[model samples]
Target chain A: MFPEELKYSKEHEWVKLEGNVATIGISSYAQEELGDVVFVELPKAGQEYKANDEIGVVESVKTVSTLYCPVSGKVTAINDELSTQSALINQDPYGKGWIAKVEMSNPAEVESLLSAKDYQSQLAG
Target chain B: MLKKTALYKNHIDLKAKMVPFAGWEMPVFYPAGIIAEHKAVRSSCGVFDVGHMGLINIKPQTSNIKKAEEFLNKIGTNDVSKLIDFSCQYSVLCNEQGGVVDDVLIYKLIDHYIVVVNASNTDKVLAWLSSHAQDIEIEHLLDMSILAVQGPRSLDVIEELFGEEFGFNVLKRNNFLQVGNILVSRTGYTGEDGFELFIPLEEIEIIWDKVVEMKVQPCGLGARDTLRMEAAYPLYGHEYDEKTTPLDAGYSWAVKFGKGEFIGSKALSKEKEAGPKKRLVGVVLSEKNVPREGFKLFNGGAEPIGEITSGTFSPTLEKPIGLAYINNSCHEKNISVEVRGRRVAGEIVTLPFYKHS
Candidate 1:
């Protein structure tokens, strides 16, 4: 189940916007499909990125997947705890496993992301 | 289209994540996850649907033991004579150029020998045997299915199911016994002690359901890979391929250099004298970064040495482990692996990253 407050991407990432800074992490569905999260690579703070840019990577024991930015922004902060406790993504992807915080370069970019209902439909199909 | 085994429906009923592997649609893991299944195999009993492995029975010609011994020795790298009755031996089928065709397990029965090969290389191995072996009756038992029940508690589960029919106490490692129509062997791919039961396809579901009823964890290929990697067992495609030999995979002991005429014996002997191009070694990462297959390896400095063949996070050891074939010159401790363009410090350690005491 996707949270109503969050916007989702087709790549299974979720974003939470508070004013111009948007918090991002992979959805619970993504983590569940990934089985166990063994490692996470997040973009460094102050790094600028465009929408759909490959910002980081997440690795399970069997697979490696690239993480894409859903909105154009500069990385204001990243979850440092993921380096030691990547399982947090599998345990609680929405809360403690939040990957990064970006200072949105274009506030209008949030409208391009899927709503919770749209994300649920996408997963259903 | 991918082929499905007899247990495919059962895996789907349990909500397993299915993936295509070696032409078969097999379960990669279940909801309990890979680490949980791996721990089950290491700590207790776990049943794997290895139905894809090929079972080839080489019946004796004129019931002559010498002929069977001679035929097997020609194809196998390990000495077939060392195998006692009801025992199993690991060997590889090599080409004339000393490259491995496929790794196999030869089981010596009372009247015939059975060779178990990788599912993907079954046809290739059969063709190789057919061309080299003369007058030996080679029967590909495709109707049979294999179930690898592994761990310390494997016999306990087997005893619960077939206690009255068979005795588990006498089945030593690398040995097998017949119970009714099934062949139960004390051999497994995992380093853990277990039994590999080769049973008829029609009756396999009965044993599979019974084992599941006893709460033996039903593992998939995902856990199988991690467990074997932790045990330091070389996978066919990962460690050795058509161009890689046993010696290149750090299995020189399996190749008897001075043995009688056999396939690749001459080339292997020459390579032994001249030295191999690369050597396989176990690498343990000091950082938490998980090194994956094809990730580049470097020596203590920036000089690129080789690449990783198989890698995973060892659940038992609680560290990242990998297997790589580094250049012979960089055969030292304290190497580095480049994952995503960043070098992570790694130390070359001995094989069998996890061993049961």
Candidate 2:
């Protein structure tokens, strides 16, 4: 169930660009693969991260997975609700489960991300 | 190639997430997820398709029951002579080095004894039993299927399925009874009043469908592991391996030394007198980070004390809990586990993180 407006990465992350700030969260497929999310460790705001850097950690009942930064930028905000309710990622991966918002440092990185159709094909392949 | 259980098609119909485990393509969880399946068993009722476990029968060549008992007693850590008809006992097979070969449940039937071994160690245990056979016949029941119905409401589910006249409600724990073609045992891995039904391969699907029709949640191995962990049950390859003795695994009560000479008895007796070098202990982490298997343990020092054997987030306790084999020398009050290369503070707690009262 890939949203049409979202850009996706091979690592199963979805990004939504609204001007200079890009909202990022794991895809619905990633949440399904992780099972029930029990805990999440989000990065602090104002911290800068390069593309493909480890941005956060997601822990489910079975295992843990590392979330990667899709675009190099400073973290503007993170969803603080995940500290108490990590299952939001499973319930709403596109909306309320957004992990972080990054103020982009390199806008050209968006072109490298796959569209919703391409990302769905990548998952099938 | 992975082996499929009798309920493989049923699991697929339920939309279960299948994963490879112990050479079988088993369902790890259903669409309800592991946490929900776990909670359902805790509060209501849940069914598990554990047909992957091995069932080996030890029958005497003659009508002499004593010879069969003696043979089993020599190979197992527990006393087999104490088992009465329709009763089962938890025991462990050990190597000569005092390490565990596999933990099993020995069910003594009228004419023969059935030993249920772990799925992964089925072939090894069969060969081990065959090598030690004297006048005993060790037959593997490859076409058997095991269904475990567990929870607080498990008795009700059993009554609903088999009817009240069967008297399953009165069946004592660790005891089994033979129905027409099925053998029902009042035993389970989950810390709950439950029953394990030993059904024929062809009959398992019908029983499973009936159980599901009654609104019983069908659980997978993912929930099974968490349920057993919460109950502090020692699993093979995790707490008890070829190198881990029953003494080190906190299963001393099951090892009866007064039963006379058995496999690994001399070595285990020596270890008992001197005490185990390392002991399995439960640790509760202060943080939410899970301490996985092979993670190093520290006692507030630079040196590592031991390593985790099994770790998971306890859905009931809502905390990260684990079992570790810490060196007995390290008696520090505060311990830490290295999780993802970071130290997380923890404290040693009593076993069975969650007990059903």
Candidate 3:
């Protein structure tokens, strides 16, 4: 399941854009598949990244998954609370688990991301 | 194709995450997750389908118990003659060079003895036993299934289920009792007090359901690994490989050097005097990094001293813990491990990060 207002990436990241700043977090589907989230490595504020850049990491008991930058931007903030309570991603993936906020460098890259419907279709196929 | 245990369909019905482990399609965990299942074993009780474990029976061909005891002593690292009837002891099977073949539990039954071995090493162990067969009759009990009921409350739960006829209260650690056809032993891999039931294949489901009805957590291999590691119990493949000896894996107590002419006794006796080259040690990461197998260990330096054999985020400790084979010379109170190219500080705690009275 995915939210209609958000955009999705093939890597299971969800982006909610508000003007030039877009908040990014892993979708609920991704968190569910990872079992229990134990730790997360977040990109720092002011770090520059290109679209599809390897930016962060999420760890569960049995696996480690990389978090990819959905679109080109400079990171502005990260959810600091995740360092202590990493299970927030499993508990509330759309809200308090938001990984980072980025100031989009190229607005045109937004067109490449799939809508919620397209993402759901991609998962099905 | 992977091997399926007797409880494979039951695991599938529970929607367990089935993974290929030791050539068997076994459940890694259920929906409750590994941490919760691990906690259940620590605080209350949990059940595990250990049907994949190998069971072998050894009895003297001429009905001589002394000959059977002698045969077992020649094949096992521990002195099997020490076992009283209906008692069990942890032992290891070793190669000619004193390297570990597998760690096993030997149960002395009334008329014969049973050796429980790792699932992955069962075939090899059987072949080894056959090669060393003298006057003993070897019976392979692979068709049977084993269920492990573990944790602090396990005895009470088992007593409640089996009722007074089973006499769960009278059973001591490493002792066993036969109720109906099932042989229930007060033995477990997890550090908790528990029982491992040796049952017929047809009876596995009924017993599993009965235990589940008692509200004990149904754990899988994922929690099983974490629980054993937290207790500093060495896994066969991880801590005791074909290249490692029991003395090297922090199990010197399991090896009786003076047990008299065993397969690896001569070589082990020699090594026992000199000590092993590498020693297994427990490492608790100072950072949040989960130490993994094959990761290099350092003592606050760039050069590597050892490698991790088994590691995980301990559910009981709430931190990353690991077992490693560091150079015996470099072992100290404080050390560091290279995790993802960064040297995370770690402390050398004693084996078994947790224990309960």
Candidate 4:
């Protein structure tokens, strides 16, 4: 059940808006598809990216995936705790497992992403 | 099209993540995952439903032990001619150019020897043996369903189920235990102290149900891979194949030359006399990324030399490791592996990376 408070990317990443900076984390459906997240390679702070750009990589025991950004922004912060504690993503993806924090270039871009209800229907389909 | 084993329903019920391996539907991981499964097998006991592999029961005619022996004498240099009834020997069947046909465990069962081959190469092995042993009878070549109960504590659990029915104590390494229709062997690929119980096809489900209640955990092919890698055991397709020669792969120890004329014996002897050029070694990663198959291996100077035969996140080690064939006289122990185009350092160590106590 995706929370209605969060925003979703077509790539299945979710963003929780908190002022000019938004917290980014892969959605539950993305984690389910990716299986266990063993190692999380976070993007560097201050790194800029375009919408849907591959900024980071996450690896499970048997699989590896690139993290796609939902919006164009400067990477202000990353979850350093994931370097040693990767299971955080599997346990509380939206909370402690939040991958990175990006300073938004335009808040209007949020409207372009899918809402929680829409993402659920997308998954169901 | 892929093939499914009899225990397919059982795997799904256990919430296993199914994957295709060598054209057979197999469970790569289950509810416990590979890490937990590997630890279970190391500390206690694990049950693996390997019913997909092929088992051929061959009844050889009298006065033809030599003929039967000559057929497999091609792979190993150590003499395998003295094998008697109810004994088993691990040997590789190779081609004339020293390429491997299949690495098999031959169990001599009284009048016949049961050949257990890799599931993918069952038909291929049969075709090769049929063309070569045309003079002999190929009767009762059955694909009997089998399961392996392997671990240090496996004996304790199995003794409770089957009892001392076959006088199993007398069975040494490479020996088979036969009591009535049941055939059990003191052999396993997991490098743990265990046994491979060859149950009749119709009776597999019943025996499986009985044992699941015990201490044995249903270890799928996932744990099997990690456990084998921890023990530094090689997979047939990854380590040795039709194009790979015996000498270069460092499995030439399994090829016998002193035995009289046999297929691929001459080439193996030549390779032996010339000395092996390449050897297989264990490479453990210093970092997080798991070393995978086909990753380029480089020497200390960061020069490309060899490639990893197989690699995975070692459940027991809690890190990444792999097996690769490198030049024997390479001079340096440190080598670099190109994992996803990034240079990750690795150290080459001896074989059997992990040994269970």
Candidate 5:
């Protein structure tokens, strides 16, 4: 289930904002949609920002998908711990599985995201 | 995009993740992950909608069964004479040059025989079978549905679902036992002990729902792949096709020339005497990089030798493994895979990368 507090993207990524920083991770729905994520190539720290740009790779047993940015920002942190323990995304897509932390370049860019209800309805359609 | 099966709506109703396979919208998995579904078959029963495969029924003149023997050799199943009606076998239908046309199932169902072939090779096998057997009578050529209920617990599941009267031990290979309307055969693609049921296309949903109610997981192509690979079974298109020979695919046992004549036999005999130039071998990537399809294979000395045909991150082995066609000499020696240009040391193993538990 998606939390109404978070902003979403059509690509199934969720961004939770606190001030100008966004803790970004794939939505629980995304992780569930892509069964058994074997590996995730998260964006590197210090990488520059963009909205709807390919930032990382999320690989399941069957396919490799590109994770896109929903809001423009510069990468400040990534869950380096996921490199060796990739299954963390399946276990905790919301908290410990957060892919990267970005410092937003323009706070107004958050408006580009769809709300939780809209994302769920998008999947239903 | 509108291709649907009898159970298509039911699959969507059960929240099945559908994918396009051979132009058919088929379920690849349900809520459970691939690994979980795979393990279920290893320890319990699981059902698969292999309804996509082609089924052709042929009624050759009883006397022409001898001529059918000739087609066997023509097809690279050297052992045509040894095949009996109650006997089911795996064979590769070949073109004129001894290259595989399709890996097929030769089942003698009743007086007329039946063949179950790959969905992708349906038309090819049909045309090949038609062109060769001009004298033979092909009775009803229908698109029948087939399902595989496989795993160690499959027998029990079958008993529970269809009653013990179906004859657990009596139903031999190539022989079909009718339970109500279902024809249950002791056959499956997964190396696990199970049966492949041939039912009317329309009744697929009814039987599928019953099996699901009996706790048989509706596994998709994803689990089907991992399960078959673990069993060391060959994928028709990937491991062998119009370009690869069965002898090179470790299927020399299926070819029996002792009885009589067949197509591709002469060329296969030549290749057998001379030995296939490239052989299919199993290899496990010893490093982190996944050995994907088309990855070049090299000798331990870093010299290019061959390339991977089918590869995947094995759910059972918890590592990358694959099947590759390599030089016979290099196959005997150890080899490595070049994943994105880096040579990862891999030992040349046998057919299966993982044994069934």
Candidate 6:
């Protein structure tokens, strides 16, 4: 299930924009496909990444997946709890499972992301 | 085209995640997820639909146990003479060049021997055995389906299913008992005490349903892999292939050179004397990084020394553990695995990252 207030990327990342800060995490579909989340490699704070950059890594018991930055910006904060409790991604993908918070370099990039309805359609297709 | 096992519909009904495994469309996990399924097998009871594995029946023309033992000894690496009636022995089939064909379990029935091969290498093992046949009938038991009941409470589940009169309590490890058409062997891939039931294809669904009714968690290939890895068991194509020998895989105990000459005996014997060029070792990463198959291993050197064969996050240990074929020359304490172009520090620990108490 996807949230209506969030913007999604083709790589299955969901972005929540509040002013210039965008909270990013993987969608519920991605977490379900990954099964049990065992390890999450979060990017360091104060690191700059462009939109669509490979920012971090998320590893399930079966395989590893790359976390892509939705909007280009400098990472302001990361969820340190994910270092020990990666399964939060599976438990609550949209809430407590948020991976990183980034200060957006260009707020216009949010328009390029898929809307909740469009993302649902993309998943269906 | 992918093949479907007899329990394919059952897997679908359980809302399992189906994946292609060794030419068969098998369930990788159920809705309970891999970690839950894995933990169930370790702590409680778990049933697995292992019907995809191949079963080959070898019967001597003379029906003599001695002749049958002789025939099996020529095909496998273990000492077939030591196998008693209704007992099973883990053995490896090898090519003449000392390379492994497939690891198998030889179940010696009263007058015949049943060889269980991996699903992927079934055709090849059948062909290999047929070509090497001498005054023996090799029949592939296609109608037979295997179901494994594993974990600490496995015996209780078996007793409840077949009733107390079956004498499941007396069934020793690596031993089997036939009840009607089904053959229940006290052997399993999981490290826990368990049984593998070789049942008729038509009766598998009923037995599976009965096991499920008893609240036994149904496991899939994903949990099976993790369980075996935690037990440090070698899987075909991951630990050993046509290029590797049993000694190379740290299974020299399975290869009995004193049992007389068998396939690859000469080469394996020489390798044992000369010492193996490579040794399979268990690795535990210090960090949370999951080392995957084919990931290169380094010993604080610029060049890669070996590569990972099987790796996963140990649900029991809650750490990343793997089996790697490292060069014997690189005997360094600081072993690191190259994961995504970054070196994660690890140590070569003993085999079996987790052991059931």
Candidate 1 displacement at residue B340 in angstroms: 1.0
lDDT of 1 at B192: 96
Q: Is candidate 5 or candidate 6 better by DockQ?
A: 6
Error of 5 at B164 (Å): 2.4
Give the per-residue lDDT of model 4 (tens digit) for A1-125. Answer: 59899999988899999998888999887775555677787889999998888888887666677898888899999999998888788778889989999999977898899999999888889
How much is B138 displaced in model 2, in angstroms?
1.6
Flag regions of model 5 displaced more than 4 Å.
A1-12, A42-56, A68-75, A80-85, A104-125, B61-73, B76-78, B170-181, B300-303, B331-336, B340-345
What TM-score number comes out for model 2? 0.98
Q: Model 6, range A1-125, lDDT digits (tens) per residue?
A: 99999999999999998999999999999998889999999998999999999999999989899999999999999999999899999999999999999999999999999999999999999
After superposing candidate 3 on the true structure, give the runs of residues whose Cα lies further than 4 Å from its correct spot.
A4-10, A107-125
**Residue-wise lDDT of candidate 5 within B78-187, one digit each (tens)?**
46455666556777787767788888887764465677888878877777877777667654345468888998778887788778875776676555676776778888
Cα lDDT tens digits for candidate 2, B219-270: 9998998899999999998999999999999899999999899999999999
Candidate that scores best on DockQ: 2
Q: Rate the local accuracy (lDDT) of all candidates.
A: 0.90, 0.93, 0.90, 0.78, 0.78, 0.93
**TM accuracy, model 3:** 0.94
Model 6 clash pairs are: none
lDDT over C-alpha atoms for residue A123 of model 6: 95
Clash list (residue pairs), candidate 1: none
Residue range B213-289, candidate 6, lDDT tens digits: 99999999989999999999999999999999999998988998887899999899889889999999999998999
Q: For model 4, name the residue pairs that clash.
A: B75-B255, B76-B254, B76-B255, B76-B256, B77-B255, B77-B256, B88-B174
Model 4 chain B poorest 10 in a row by lDDT: B70-79
> Per-prediction DockQ scores?
0.75, 0.85, 0.58, 0.41, 0.51, 0.82
**DockQ score of candidate 2?**
0.85
Task: Score residue B290 of candidate 1 by CA lDDT.
Answer: 81
lDDT of 3 by residue, B1-357 (tens): 999988999889888889998889999989899899999999999999998899999888997888889888888899998999989999988988999988899999878999999999999999999889898889899668899999999988888878867678789999999888889899998999999999999989988988988999999999999999999898988898888988898788888877678988888888888888899899998888788898898876668889999988888989988999998777578888887777888888888788966
Backbone collisions counted per model: 0, 0, 0, 7, 7, 0
lDDT of 1 by residue, B234-328 (tens): 99888989889899888888887566878999998888888998988899988877888888888766668988999998889887899999887
Instruction: Assess candidate 6 and give its lDDT.
Output: 0.93
Q: In model 5, state the lDDT of residue B207.
A: 83
Q: Give model 1's TM-score versus the native structure.
A: 0.95
